[model samples]
Target: MTDSADSRASLGDGIRFAFGTLTVLPVRVARWDRAAARAGMLWAPLAGLVVGLFAAAVGGALALLDAGPLLAAVASAAVPAALTRGLHLDGLADTADGLGSGKPADDALRIMKQSDIGPFGVITVLFVLLAQIAALYELYGESWAQGALAAALSAVTARLALTLASRTGVPAARPGGLGAAVAQTVGMRTALTVAALVVAACAAAGTLFGASPVPSAAGAAHCALAAVAALAAAELLLRHCARRFGGVTGDVFGAVAETAATATLIALAVR
Candidate 1:
């Protein structure tokens, strides 16, 4: 009983840590060790779930208020940035600059660590953000419920990438920091379990929402496909990072999440 209680408490701490690290949430994490970091990653998708819900809510409210889809989409896009304080965006920028430079591993890593954004970073962020906003606008224009479901699933699947990236056999690019701390901490079984659960939850939510008078089999399929696509994209990015950067880094993880989210949203926008 005592051991079970301790495990429960630690799990709670891990959930708190996941939220605290990933978002601007007020949760305070009391522990900071490899064990805690690994535990926290298992719950990383929960943070995405929270962000997605908020984004969906924002889009829904604007739609109900008769706002234009473009405005609604922009505001919805801003939701994740606000919640995460643009942490993922920063990572996206850094990773772009690093990889685009085509420098050696050490130099690339150094470029990623710079405080200011470079030309490559600026271009990458601009294009990616615009793509997300445009895709979301199209989705919102179709149906508010569809838009919300897409947003939620995209966010969830995006963060799910982190779990895959942290799975055993993946290595850290450097000796210390977020990547090293959580790298290879997630077992293959754990990653697969989380991925399956996320995909299932998204499918269920999509089906439930699809039954709402309109009856959209496409919507349900889109949600499931988006989740799978996001995971596949993340895997490709992980392999690229391993080859280009020597291994995954904090920036690489962030880039993976953002890229996956964007890709999912784009897939949903497709007719």
Candidate 2:
């Protein structure tokens, strides 16, 4: 095969890996090697973009039918959960339980690995879901466009967090599992490039879609702010988890993704 064909095949494998692992999308992952993982992490936001668009469509449809912002918000918030089979949420719950346990790192990790949800997990999941729903409700109340933007922005930001988390210098907490497979697979430069692109696209989206056909600086700024805030919030969580767990885990990735998404939603919710 020519170099170009090899590149294309590699790209296809990456997309398959990303969607297969990050979503319930019916793509078959052709490779599970580091090369594929590297590509997949870089492509993570693209998978998120699809998920976000679907989420926005669902919520917008509900709102157009006059289901009201509350129902629309619920449906929008539920879409990501449904698409990913609630893996991220489950991670969020497990991470919360582990962190809130106030136990040693090994013990906490053990707690996170457990199947049952603990009190801390339950409470954390409840509040996080409430916050997401509440923020979506506020945005939907303002306009379906706003709600949809928030939905899409949050999803993209969530996956972007995963990309950053997988960058070089970050280690896996365990020797095996999804985290180990992808951890440190992405180069710092590659991760930053993907992140910069995502932010620019989001800002451009806001500017184009804002109040009118004419570009709106305010809309662009609003989106840029949300994206930055989401990254910052996710970064903080990633740092803490690294310190707490000694490195990243599948659960930590989930926790940071949810954190970024929630932060993005909250940032957009503010008037």
Candidate 3:
């Protein structure tokens, strides 16, 4: 009983840490050890879930208010940035600049650490953000329900990338920072378990939302497919980053999340 209670407490800390680190949420994390960080990665998807719900709510409300899809798409796209202080977007930009430079590993890493965004970073962010808005606008035009479901699931799927990237076989790019701190902290078994749970939860949520008031099988499938596609995209990005950068870094994780989310949204918008 004592051991179970301790485990429960640690899990709680992990959840808190996940939210604290991933979002601009005001939740306080009581622990910051390796154990807590591992636990945090396991629960990171939940942070995405929160972000998704908020984005969905914003988009849904705009749709209800008869706002055009363009405005709704822009607002929904902005929600994650506002909530997370655009952290993932910043990572996406930095990673783009680094990778686009085609420099040696050390120079690429140095470029990524720089504060200024290069031409590659500028173009990447511009196109990526435009793609997200365009996709969400298309989705919203199809059905408000579809837009909401896609928004929520995309967020969750994107965050799932973090767990996969932190698995035991993945290494840190450098000696310190979030990459080193979380590198190899998640075992394969743990990552698979988390992935399974996330998929299940997303499916259930999609079904619930898809069926409310007006049911649409196509909408539900879109959500599920978006999740799967997002995961696949993240996995590909992770592998590429691992090879290109020597291993996964915190920036890599962010880039994966944003890219996955964008890809999912785009997939959902497809006919």
Candidate 4:
């Protein structure tokens, strides 16, 4: 195909991939094959923007229903899961189950791929989601904007963590999967660019919205904590996974992103 034709085809594929992730579609386009991997990676933050905004809107609407913080927080979570159909949540469970096995790399990978959920996986998913809901509930007190910003920060930072993990030596567990695709598509340059963008965004956020953020200190803290916690939690999870399984699967990446976001929000609540 001509270059122009290839560009158009690539664009179509990327749109499909993003749409598939955000909706209940079976479309699965690998990240690398896109003609604009670098630009496409930007989709990560964009997903956060969409998901975060939807979550905040849900909470706001629920507030009008006289829902408590818990209910509002629960509402906040529904949008993300619906958008991605719990894809990352599944990854989190699988990774937790696989790593909890304490078996050899091959064995762990095998267990992770199983359709049946293990005890560890079940508990991990529950606690993580609970933490996120609880923290978001705390942020739901008065400032929808703060809650929305926190959610947005969580989503974007979680994706940024994914971008960060791409630079590490975590090879794909399989030959053909999202892990392999992202690893191949996201190079040093792409990762670095994302990093710079994230930093800039955070700086701008803190300067612009730090003082009036919801729950006052507590709410702002959660938002900031969620962002940092997302990165830290993902790093720890990836390290543990690497040590246990020798490599990361696409599921692990999603799992890590979800887990990190949950942990970040939870930490903010408790702090």
Candidate 5:
């Protein structure tokens, strides 16, 4: 039998591998580069779970304190914004500026890489955040579990899009960026695993804590629609990126995944 100390060490390594240290695991287990990148896509929902729980508590606290719902409203977004350190938000900005620059495609790509923000990029990030805040504010009143489900699945759906980003037409910009290594590592099986889990979550949420028949039905519909839309959006983007850069890159994956999640959540919440 393994010694107690060895067992404990194994546990610690497993925790680090799952939690924040994605690169520590063996490359053969899932491939170091792909595993880390997939973590970028897959773990959003896990991040959402943590953030959603906090948001749910914040909303409940607001209800108790009689501060009104809006404060808690913004607070929900605070968690995700903090978790990603606004990495996707940066992608959103760079993508917007690059697309809108009207410069040659190569110049636009270069601009996205430059560590500067432009008028378009700044506006893009703010407006995107504003839209997210509004959608989440509406969802604040929903059950904590439901809200949590939505947050986690939204992130997962975004990453599902990332699988498509790497696999579909997008050619990598260069040999190295975030895109190249992942393109080799990410595969159909990993993506399909994500897809299966997303579906399971949606079904389970509806069966478990749905408020009313109508709302439950609506929630189920929302999840289905969100998944379809996210996938479609990812596909469209990969096609564009393939044509534009001759291949996808890590930044492109970030941009596509963020856009898909935001759009999916907004679409589901609003209608």
Candidate 6:
């Protein structure tokens, strides 16, 4: 095949891998090679964008139907969980349990692998969800556009965190499963490029939010800042998990994603 043809095939496989693994979308992954994993991590934000749009739509619809910001926030918060089949939340919970255990790396990994949620897991998940809902409520109260932008921004930010976590040099915690399949697959340069693009696009989108030019410019700045904050927060969690677990795992990826999403919402909620 020509180089162009190879590129097209690789791109297609990347989309499949991204949507198939990162989401509960119907896309069937056709390749599990490092090439595909690299492309998939690079494209993860696109999957997040789709999920964010769905969440925004649902929240906006609720607000339009005379539902209050609280309900709109609740609905928006639920959409990502529903779309991803709660996998990320479960990961956050498991990661909490592992970290809370404070055991050796092996024991912590074992705790994370267990299906049941422990006390620490339960409390952490509860607080995270509450924080997300509270942030969404504040944004929704400002305006429908504000709320919607936050919803979308957060989702994209979440996946962008995963992309960063998968970059080369981040080791996998185990020899098998999703972590091993994608860990250290993306280059640092590629991850940074994708992140910069996402932030630029989000800033452009935010400029459409407010009526006056000043507000619009502020909106753009806020959007950009929110992305930066989300990444910063997720990075902290990623580093902690890597050190604690001796490397990244599927649980770590999920935890990173949720942390980023929550941080985005919280940042946007601030006046």
- Number of the top candidate by lDDT? 2
How do all the candidates rank in terms of TM-score, highest first? Answer: 2, 6, 1, 3, 4, 5
Worst 10 residues of 2 by lDDT: 1-10
Give the per-residue lDDT digits (tens) of candidate 4, residues 10-69: 654655555455445465656445344333444566656666677767876776667766
Locate the minimum summed-lDDT window of 10 residues in model 6: 1-10
**What lDDT does each candidate get?**
0.85, 0.91, 0.83, 0.67, 0.59, 0.90
Instruction: Tell me model 1's lDDT, rounded to 2 decimals.
Output: 0.85
Candidate 2 lDDT tens digits, 145-217: 8898889989999999999999889899888989999898887877898899999988987885467878998
**With candidate 1 superimposed using the best TM-score fit, by how many Å does residue 135's alpha carbon deviate from the native?**
1.0
- lDDT tens string, model 6, 1-271? 1222223337789989999999998989999877788788888999999999999999988988879999999999999999999999999999999999989999999999999999999999899999999999998898887788889989999999999999877899899989988888877777899999999988988796666655488878888998999999999999999999999999889999999999999988887
- Runs off by more than 4 Å, candidate 3: 1-9, 208-218
Best-to-worst ranking by lDDT: 2, 6, 1, 3, 4, 5
Candidate 4's TM-score reads: 0.81
Where model 2 places Cα greater than 4 Å from the true spot, the runs are 1-9
TM-score of 5: 0.74
Give the alpha carbon lDDT tens digit for every residue of 1-271 in model 1.
1212223337787898789888898999888776677778889989899999999999878977889888878888899999988998999999999999999999999999999999999999999899999998998898887777777878888889998898888889998878887888777777799889888777777674464676467666768887898789888988999999889999999899998999998987877
* Global fold similarity of model 6 (TM-score): 0.95
Model 1, residue 171: what's the lDDT?
87
> What C-alpha lDDT, on a 0 to 100 scale, does residue 237 get in candidate 6?
94
Q: Report backbone clashes per prediction.
A: 0, 0, 0, 1, 8, 0
Whole-model lDDT, model 3 = 0.83
